[model samples]
Target: MAGIAIDGISMVYTLPGGGEVHALNDVSIDVDQGEIVSILGPSGCGKTTLLNIIAGFLSPTAGEVRMGGTRVEGPGAERGMVFQQGALFEWLTVARNVAFGPRMAGSPVAEATEKVERLLTTVGLQGFGDKPVYQLSGGMQQRVALARCLANDPDVILMDEPLGALDALTREKMQNLVLKLWKDTGKTILLITHSVEEALFLGERLIVMAPRPGRIEREFRLPFPEQALSQPAREVKAGPDFVATREEVLSMIWNMEEEIMGQAEADQG
Candidate 1:
């Protein structure tokens, strides 16, 4: 029942030209136990950078990240990550790729088989396990990646635009699939995406981050556990509150993008 605590994470990177780039400043967010939190922002808004910090791939310049009670200094099995390109090994079959995590952890093949099969079913890839990773479409490959991450049985899942490359229809399908898996497995998930509609639909809690030194801009608690998945998405989206939140986030990003662009313009002027 452990969830991640991101306490005032701040990061600054020095460019080769000697200028400092402030990526995130005091970006504090928390995903409660079994909560699905979605973060949305424009490009260069440090959304992926924030995910990297949570995965322990990049250390914050200041502040701390903790799970349960222990601090995170580096990557661990408890934090599983999925990337934008699916990042699957082309040489491995779907089943083998899914088994990689458990095998590395020293779990016997027989014991791991059940988990693999269940995850494949969860992602709608149940019968494609024996296929080569290259044979699948982009959307299907991401599904395999989702299945692979679930096979590890990690405490928290961090995803960086995992469905961003798919076609519009496929992306919608994957969005629903993500909701299904989160509800079924009760995994603590922190997903970073640029789609405001997605953040509103898939997340039980919505976290909005501002750019030019990413920090918490806003947060909203969902009204119900199954509000997003209980009915037709089109119908649910027609509700006034969903539309209002969507517009609010859109305005936030619009302003942030303008500010970033204006800064660049002023420098040129």
Candidate 2:
């Protein structure tokens, strides 16, 4: 009855040419309740695909994903997702977008409105509620997206590089925002990111995925959530253990380049 379980799963996709693309190979990961774990990997390693499987957006070729002792066959509100692109509805106002979930789940408008109001402020988007999603700044739009995902109060949150599209400065601010939200919510979180620094800063446990036919290559345990934000990220980023962990993760990913290239060739051949 842990938060979520990825049990010995592998996924294969068939291309139009009748060729098989192996996305995952016997990948197994256990995310404990209220813990935040990050998945890092080289490009084309299917890290995102694994995340999708966990979210029930795709069925695994083999094995299963379970949450709260129940099998995950399709999307459910118990698991909320913050996609990389925000994925907000273009036509809805900010408040409407956040209220969308609860309303659909049979919440009365009065209750949904009240919940939306609280969530907008939680993500620092209080006054932006009535603004058209397109009218808000990039950071604010993302805040709305985050609040929207949280409105239903899911037990687990899955993020696929949610801040990856932001400018460097905005990305840092959003990282802190996400950390604060995680602390407040204490939801089990699975984040997939390409940035090593990001993975280190946000994850309580970090799992590095190997090149194509992605498998767990390395894991690191950190006492990060206990670290005070009184110290700047740059200061923590320079710690001996932090540097070593980053290098270890980076080395594993860099070494996978050849393997990914080979897999691509094999598929092409």
Candidate 3:
């Protein structure tokens, strides 16, 4: 029930030589409770940086971030993160990995065990719970990662290219799964992705960023995802609106890339 507020955030990374690299500049975004937002951009556009700032993994050099109006100073259980790769403990079984969060939070053994079962079922990994993480397929591993995040019952989910590593078929499958989870749980989700198709399919709102002092350059309120909810994802994606939106976003990003290259050339000249 908590929304996120990012106000004028800027991040500057100081190199060993004292040179400063401004990764983000005055980037601001708001994610309402239970809303799903996706971010897209070319490489080095600070998409991940903004997600990190929201997750409280990195403090902004300027401005502040708040979750449900409380300032975000550092990592907390209210926000759960899913990375590009399933970073599950290779040594632990899928069930254990899912149970880890609850146990760590001091939930009773019975309670955590029941929660793990429910989460595993939620992620479609019910029977695979006892399997070692190393044995599961790449897609299944990601499922475990999702289950683990959900087990914590976090108010917000931060996914950094969560489907980027999967094969095309698997990625598409996971896209629907993400939508299902978002609708079923009603938790706020902020996704960072490189695929315009994926973003269009999953995001109720889409944000596009530009690099070299990365910032949000464009945003769209998309109807495709909501449409996909009632229709098949493939049908929705193939619709005229979806295709048109994808092209517009692609052109926008392509222009941003050209601008970045132009700036670099001028700097060298």
Best by TM-score: 3
Writing each residue's lDDT as its tens digit, candidate 2 over 148-167 gives 99998888999999988899
lDDT per residue, candidate 1, 92-124, as tens digits?
Answer: 999999988999999999988888888888788
lDDT of 2: 0.87
| TM-scores of the models, in the order given | 0.95, 0.93, 0.97
Model 3 regions lying over 4 Å from their true place: none
By TM-score rank, best first, the candidates go: 3, 1, 2
lDDT leader: 3
What is the per-residue lDDT of model 3 for residues 13-132, given as tens digits with 9 covering 90 to 100?
Answer: 999999999999999888899999999999999999899888888999999998877999999999999988848999999999999888888889999999899888888988887899
State the number of backbone clashes in model 1.
0
lDDT of 3: 0.91
TM-score of 3: 0.97
Candidate 2, superposed: residue stretches over 4 Å from native? 228-230, 258-269
For candidate 3, the per-residue lDDT at 179 reads 95
